[model samples]
Target: MPRSALPPLPPPAHLRPWLDDAVLRADRARFLTDLSRRSLGIGRLLLLWAVAAVFVLGWTFVGMAWMDVERHEFFSYVHGLIYTVLGVGVLIPAVFWLVRGIRQDRQVRQLLHAWVESDRDPAADARLRAPGLSLVWLLASFALGVLGLWVAFGAAASAGPSRTTSGELAYIMGTGQILWITGLLGLAKAVVHYRWAVRAFRSRN
Candidate 1:
């Protein structure tokens, strides 16, 4: 083909205007807003778990009180039934929601990566950093794990000598185990976030 008939070339880097600061700021803001909205769903799921845990504790206390006062056979059965139902009803849905949130978060991350790749602007890197767990959260998780283990072991040690009823002891142990598990999960999550943040910082450098 004749040179004059050839397609035009893309504008050179020096010839193109710099991406506007205002536009960049707007893009960053929009990205953060979307992320926050998505994260809110996860927060709600966690909140549900908290509420369910509170309910379980409350019922356990009531059941213990009933046992101490007068162990009615029918009431005992009813108490166990309610506890089982509430535990299953709440935990199952909470777990389901948690899994869904995780999947959604992964999808959002992929979308964010694609967005960054499309722009290829060094300035955008600052805005592209993934959210990580805070120091406060890490400390809280560790503390909770330790406290839970302490409670669980303490109850086990005292149960035999204190002559505590089997039902009450079981409840205490279960609560402690739940707390310990949750705390460990939190700690793991914090560690993952820390590692990811470190990798991102290194990549940026």
Candidate 2:
């Protein structure tokens, strides 16, 4: 095909980083480094969730441990074994991730310093600008957040003041809290993306 016959490229402002080969190739190392930092952010979020899970599990065990023995000797032994195994399994990873996060934070800061000193490509920068998220996703995330809040609090309420710390009730409430918090984070990201998209659109118009 002749050069003139080739299709015209989209406007620079409209280019997407993930979709643009030129952007990816322009600074592959920086892109990958940035991606690592983003991954660390996700890891941090997971760490928070893990902490919450541990707290819930710890209290649930406190309630269930005695209940199990009272309910059935054989079943109590089995429950204790299961709890030990699960606790160890979750704890090991959570600790590892927590330690890793500290190292990752230091590395990210170094990388950020390097990135600041490095030269940048204007075209690539423009392409790296992410578009806004969909409205549907935003709404769905918000709904999930609402549902999570209701589930967490409702479970706690149902347990009554006398049994608020009961194992079964604690598990239900903790699960709900985690769900709502995750949903809330998602909703926040969606809103930010949507705002950015709107701003970009306005700039163009």
Candidate 3:
């Protein structure tokens, strides 16, 4: 009589680095705390950006209306248009990140629960430690940075002698500066994420 043996199961695809049971047991509390901090940080950042966007939008509209009424000029309309577009450009990504962060917070909580239930199984731990960066997010970050730069440059160029008045120069410069700073910040974030991704890949390989 002959007997057959079952084939070995494949490892989890999402398994990541730093999933050892000892590490998990030692750092579980800190890890959860860090997750909470990240969630709260993201929430605060989103709220701040949302408020800023609203303020900018309101200022653009009200200022444009006032300018049109007082000066009888179309330049205000153009300025409003540029500011609105840039504001929206930044707002959209901020919203996306906010939503994503909320979802990630939930996911991490579930993972924490699973890890506890599983007694910190290696596979579960690996799943929890899996890298979150994706091509879509990377591309979006890059696009946001580019858009910010483009808006900044456009704002600055629009303030040139032929198109704008002395009174408008300050507004244009302020808008450009805001956009440039935001763009640089976004780029820096992207770079940091990209480095993390590289490290994750290297570890996995």
What is the TM-score (0 to 1) of candidate 2?
A: 0.49
Q: Write candidate 2's Cα lDDT for 1-205 as tens digits.
A: 2421212222243454446565544554445345333423344445545664664465455445544644557978788667656656665665676566556555543443343233344443343233322344456557767877898888866777565545567567766776686567556655654564355445544
Ranking by lDDT: 1, 2, 3
lDDT of 3 by residue, 61-137 (tens): 44444444445557856665665566566556656765664566456445444333433334433433323433333
Better of 1 and 3 by TM-score: 1
Top candidate by TM-score? 1
TM-score (C-alpha, index-matched) for candidate 1: 0.61
Clashing pairs in 1: none
**What are the clashing pairs of model 3?**
none
Whole-model Cα lDDT of every candidate shown, in order: 0.56, 0.53, 0.47
- lDDT (Cα, tens digit) per residue for candidate 1, span 1-205: 2421212222244544666656654565556435533433346336534743664555465445545434557777677566566656665665676576467656654544444333345555544343432354467667877877887888898988348776667777767776776667666655654565466556556
TM-scores, all candidates, are 0.61, 0.49, 0.41
